[model samples]
Target: MMQKEWTTCFPFLNQMPDDERRRFLQSAVPHQLYAGEVVVREHSKCVGVVFVLSGELKVYKVSESGREVALYSVFPGEAALLTVNCMVAQETPVADVSLAAMQESLIAIIPSSAFFYLYSVSPQLQQFIFSCMYKKFNAIIDLVEKMTFKNVSERLYEYIRENTGSGRIPLYTTHAQLAARLGTSREVVTRCLKKMQRAGFLQTERGKISLLEKPEP
Candidate 1:
């Protein structure tokens, strides 16, 4: 029954015939994570693939100076396949996984050996893998473009615009956290925020930032 629940969370598996779904489910092992747990880490051996049945996970990389730059956030019904690649290639993981639970969560762990076998035999699984890889690849490309060509202010603006549906973005982050997200120093972020505040673009008080302008395109 738990296996059925795990399979249901994966959209790719939903279309599969029952027999095939059962085969896929047989390859997975159940696992649980607590809030604030490190599910994976940089330079660590990857054990298997993770299917998040519940909860959220933040995928990030730590800088040499020990700063975390968040890459993406994963929630229930999403899976992380990078760990499978690492185990298959016998290489260390490139990022760290931090579990953030709004509530308790469960996951299905599929061992690398079983995953490889499934990939070899299942055409549907292959297509799913390909689609996932393509999306991840495109995301990395987008990140590169942002880091290389976009200024910190632009990035911050984009971040704010993306997160807030309305023109007014009520900021709920500290200056330091904003700096990390912008890939700049806290002083720089503070300076930019001050400038924007003066221009009526936004305002900040007690670590809260609010966007006053709709942000220019």
Candidate 2:
């Protein structure tokens, strides 16, 4: 029987026919990730697709100066299929990113060859891949827009709003992390944050941040 938690992470898998799901699951090899471990490295030959079964993974790219810029994060059920795409195309990844486990995690890896064979034989699998790709593309578009049009403060606010979902963004990240996401220096982020705080837009405490007012859209 498929675990209830697994269904929550992979709702689509729950809808699949039992036999199909079983077969697909069989193709996935399980592995463990310790906290702070790198699950994947950019430009490394992708051998398979990896799906997080538990915990959180931070996907980040290194800037030219070697600063880490966080791209996004993936939790349970989210598969890093872009790596598989790179492998299939035999192309080097454009970004130098790594997947670091924020907590202990379990991952399921499916070989690229097996995935291709299964995708060819199963229309459902193909549809799933396309849908995932579409969403990934949209996310990339959103990121590009933010990076291009928004200032550092605006970008930081947008990220906080989206991640918190409740207007109140907890300030757990370091200033250095914020700087990377903002494409600036830690001092710059610190100065901007202080300015915002003085303007009554936000309040920052020890490792915590509260949004005091919504920025004008």
Candidate 3:
């Protein structure tokens, strides 16, 4: 990516001191990730600070049964902060914590050594990193709360409602994929979806689920 394009994704670079910004941009490595590619594997050493320029990245964990449970997604203008903790500590992640491209994506990475240097000297970089990390942390916390306190059916309803936003909306994900995102089995998701369908809440077709009407209180 051109320097201009990179700057456009991370506008905070404009606020950084010239020398610091220059060093950071000079060290960054851009990579193109294809859909379904696993960019970072579980229990590995930190890759670096990943900057998503476009498309999406999914952060997930693999259970012993080989089921993948999604933690969250990183989109354009966002960074996957899970790596930040590992990067700063110079240690492998404690959890399975893996990252995969949810779709074709462009990402720029600052190597761990360069990141530490830039983070120390550039307050703007520090602020930007921490701000992103804080937001992602809050999202993870909310996900945890829901997973712990809500049943699969309730979570499924909320997921559909939240994604629907307003009006009938089509979601382009398979039952297995929704199961992964909601930390459940495909059969469970399918049953819950069938129940919802019977209740006039949604309609399911191959590779798609569409909201039909809002659930009553």
Candidate 4:
């Protein structure tokens, strides 16, 4: 019964043999995190592969200057690849790689030893992990290109378009959170957002942003 739920969220688990599946499921543990809670910290030991069963996780790295630059987000049915990398390499991440709950979240942790054993024998698990790596690698490349070539306003507008898939964006985060995601300061994000608002590009309300005009793609 419970196994069905985990396999539903992580379909790859369904491909495992009964023994391996039972072992893995028996070892995996679930945790709940409140919004704004920091779950993984810099230099902390890699605990296990984190599978988000519900809600969102933000993956970011902190700089020496106390700035945070978001790498990507982990949604339901997704795993945190950085944690997988760290666990595989058996090394503490040096770039201050961090993970936090962007909202109230329910996540499961597959113990490192169990994950390592399963990864060795489960081709399905390997495929899923590598697939995640490939997709996230491209996203990081895109972020780097934007940071290198695009101006702040252009980057911010691009972010808006990406998130506003339905032409409206729920204000799920604060200006500071936006800055971290955009690799900029809160003040810069605020100024750019205000400028966009004045330009009639969007309408900012208490908990949402409504697009008045869509940018030329």
Candidate 5:
């Protein structure tokens, strides 16, 4: 996106002080990424703050056996806290999480020093950080609960319901992606998905899956 478009997405940038705004703009580098591109790899240190200006990003965790569980996703207008965490804490952040482009994406990269400076001086930015952090924390906690307590079928059902909210939109994803998000094998997900298709809970065709009806309580 152009400077005008980026500023429009973040209107507060127009209100920032001259020096602060200059520093912010100077540090905010742009990156264009393709689908499946990993933004932050497992065990890698933060280079800078990353936020999506367009498209989507999937942040996930991988297990020892090569399974993956989604942490959360960063969409247009959402700021990722991974790099921010590193800047604020000073201590080394965990590198187990990976952030990848879910589709064609436009990301703005901000320097850590500039991020810290703005974080200290801009109340609006600070408020935004706090709000984003709170949300990210709750999501991680929910993921932990699912991993610990929910059975695979139950988790798969939950994932389907959550992603295809209101049951109107067909889930635009593949079995492999679902398996990665669920931290299970593709065969396991495919088996269960086939079972779901037979049971009238869902239908799969091509690359998308659509929920058929709400499950019984």
Candidate 6:
């Protein structure tokens, strides 16, 4: 891959000096992941800073009951916050949540040491890293707030709408995936979805959910 062409799509790296950018590009290791592949597991050390060049991943936590709860979805141009934490701390950061590829993905993996070196020398990069930390922290806070206040049905609606927006119907996801995102059981999510379908709000088929009514954000 051409270094200049690849980094052009990434906003954070675009602000670096040419020499720094070249060095950083040289250090990156590209990785490809198929859907359902585990990117990182809970309590395991992060291998490197992962920058998603394309496709999606879900960051989530699993309870003792083996129920999975999604924390967030990471898209292209975003890096894992745990990786950044590891870079800043100069130690292998143990993950509290798991991450898995939601779709086939292209990712650029930068060693923590190389990232830290750039962070120290580039003020712009330092600020960008700090900004990433702030945004991810806020995202976690938002997730907590939503889960605490929102009912299962409402949360399911939000999740569907988030993925599909108002235009598309029949989002490609399983009931188990929806349950994970909503922090509920698959049975509960199925029940809620059925209710919505009956109420003319949505429809569910095998491996898909379609909105019958456009939901508010």
Candidates' C-alpha lDDT = 0.71, 0.72, 0.85, 0.84, 0.82, 0.80
Q: TM-scores, in order shown? A: 0.77, 0.81, 0.92, 0.91, 0.87, 0.90
- lDDT (Cα, tens digit) per residue for candidate 5, span 35-108: 99998887788878887889989888788877787888887767888767655555666455788998999999
Candidate 2 lDDT, 1-217, residue by residue in tens: 2467666777777667787777778788888889778877775666777778888777778766887776666767677755556666745533245667767888888877777776667666667677767776777777778889988888877766665565554656668767766667888788888988888777877656777765574
Candidate 3 lDDT score at position 85: 69
Show model 6 residue runs off by greater than 4 Å: 87-92, 214-217
Cα lDDT of model 4 by residue, 149-190, tens digit: 999998987787768864555444577878999999989988
Q: Estimate, for each residue in 1-217, the C-alpha lDDT of model 1 and write its tens digit.
A: 3656665677778777787778779877887777656777776777778877887666666778977666656667766756656666644444344323323568777877787777787787788777767776777778778989999888887877676554545767788777766667888888888888777777779867777765564
Candidate ranking (TM-score, best to worst) = 3, 4, 6, 5, 2, 1
- Better by lDDT, candidate 3 or 2: 3
Find the candidate with the highest lDDT and give its number.
3
Residue clash pairs of candidate 6: 170-210
* Better by TM-score, candidate 5 or 4: 4
Error of 5 at 191 (Å): 1.6
Q: List the residue pairs that clash in candidate 3.
A: none
From the highest lDDT down, the ranking of the candidates is 3, 4, 5, 6, 2, 1
lDDT of 6 by residue, 92-125 (tens): 4677678889999988888877877877898867
On the 0 to 100 scale, the lDDT of residue 12 in model 4 is 86
RMSD of each: 3.6, 3.2, 1.9, 2.3, 2.4, 2.5
Write down the worst ten-residue block by lDDT for model 1.
94-103
Off by over 4 Å in 1: 1-8, 30-36, 91-106, 168-171, 205-208, 215-217
Candidate 6 has its poorest 10 consecutive residues by lDDT at 83-92
